[model samples]
Target: MKAIYLESINAPFVLIEKEKPTAGPGEAVVQVKAAALNHRDVYIQYGRYFTKEYPAILGSDGAGIVTEVGAGVAPDWVSKEVVLDPSTDWGDNPGVHSKEYKVLGMPQEGTFAEYVKVPATNLHEKPAHLSFEQAAALPLAGVTAWRTLFTKCALQPGEKVLITGIGGGVALAALQFAVALGAQVWVTSSSEEKIEKAKALGATGGINYKTENWGKALKADVGGIDVSIDGAAGEGFVQLVKVANPAGRIGMYGGTTGMIGQINPAEIFWKQLNIYGSTMGTNQDFAAMMAFVREKKVTPVVDSTFRLEETEHAMRYMEAGKQFGKIVLRVG
Candidate 1:
């Protein structure tokens, strides 16, 4: 078997031959057909993640066929086409994850190889509508978007939604899911090209965040936003607050820009606004996300594809931030 091996921090992710992984008890070995890149994979190279490991196989999302199943697993699982849920040991609490929780790519071998083993519980039958590459793109970003809107915000139909950084995978998924649920969507981006593309994807309109007072302008143009989803909670997060309708919900998934800075307590209290911090979701959330994608026939936007041998180049492309959607790695 061949896998992308990260030898150390700041090292290249090189393809290396290795013994194929075997299924452990209650686990299954998937023959990966496709895998998707997340910023987390890039963060590992720079040693920027909260957790890190050397000589690692880093990939969080993948689609594949189960070729081997361990003891206690159903025989039916073998040869099943599946998309894996990266979240594990989510514990009993639905509102938040437990200390045992870990994503697939770190501290455990992930989907960057021709064969990877995972707990069978993480496998869900792949959506029939999606190709392997498309299914590979759905897990992490899809669940992140799903938890932000549907779980944290409880988004309602006919309400207005504001998704920041429209070109990224999670943001794109948020926009698509919101639209599919009958919400009117708007987005924020520095790239005019991305904004236009977002509009084509059911967003009503979008504004260039580079423009002065862009937040105020968006509020004026769209009226009040009922739910706003953002991964970058930088200085612009306050602006999301500025644009929200009274009693609106704001879901923050990541802090790419760092620091919440200062927020006006008065605005939050006066409007009765809800600010919810979120991450890649619980098992229940993954189940609901899968069901939603299946029911709505949601297809993830594939920005590009690269062979597993080109994992290094793909990582750089993702780091460049030029991609408008998920960048996938095609595996054997």
Candidate 2:
């Protein structure tokens, strides 16, 4: 099997031949067809993640055909096309993950290889509406978006939702999910081009955060937003608070822009607004996300595709923050 090995933090990825992985008990070996890049992968390369293990395979999102199943696993799983959940060891608690929870692609070997092993419980049938590349894009970003909108915020139809940093995969997935659920979607992006692209994907309109007083602009132009899904938690987060309606829910998934400088306590307390923090998601969240994708026929946005050996290039593209959607790697 061919895999991209990250020798160490800040080291370049090396494409090398390696022994194919086999299924252990309760696990299955997937012959990977495609893999997608996430910000986590980039963070791992830059030594920004919690784990510092070296010579690791780095990818979390993948879709492929099952080639083998371990003892105690159902034989029927073989020859099935499935997408990997990548969220491993999510414990019993529904509201939050246990200490045992860990995402794939760090301490564990991941999908940036011809073969990768995963727990059978983590597999979901590939959505009929998506191809291998598109299926690979959905697991991480789709689950994050799903948990943010439906689980944490409980976004409803016909409501106004705002997704900040519209070009990233998770934000784009949120846009798709909200639009399909009959919500009026709006977005914020530093790039006007990305904002226009988001509008083409069903966003009502968008604002460029680079503009001074953009938060006031949103409040003036769009009235008040019922929900704000934000990944960047810098000063712009205050903008989200400004545009939110009273009792609006704010879901924070990532703090890409670093610490928030200031926030008005009165705005939150007086408005009775709710703020929630979300990560990847639980197993139940993954299941419901896939069901929604299948039922809604949602297609994940694919910005581009690179060959498996081009994993380094894919990572660099994602690091540049130039992609409007998921950047996938063709594996098999």
TM-scores vs. true structure, each candidate? 0.98, 0.98
Model 2 C-alpha lDDT per residue in residues 249-330, reported as the tens digit of each score: 9999999999996998999999999999999999999999999898899999999999988888888888888899999999
lDDT for each of the candidates?
0.94, 0.93
In model 1, the Cα lDDT at residue 283 comes to 88
- CA lDDT, candidate 1, residue 303: 99
Best by lDDT: 1
Off-target runs (Cα >4 Å) in candidate 1 are none
RMSD of 2: 0.9
Which pairs of residues clash in candidate 2, taking residues 3 or more apart in a chain or in different chains? none
Write model 1 residue lDDT over 1-332, tens digit each, in one string.
99999999999999999999888889999999999999999988889888887879999999999999999999999889999999888889899898988999898988999998999999999999999999999999999999999999999999999999999999999999999999999999999999999989899999888888677998888888999999999888889888989999999999989888688898899999999999999889999999999999999999999999999999999999999999999999
TM-score, candidate 2, is 0.98
> Could you tell me the lDDT of residue 239 within candidate 1?
92
Estimate the lDDT of model 1: 0.94
Error of 2 at 68 (Å): 0.2
Q: How close is candidate 1 to the true structure, as a TM-score?
A: 0.98
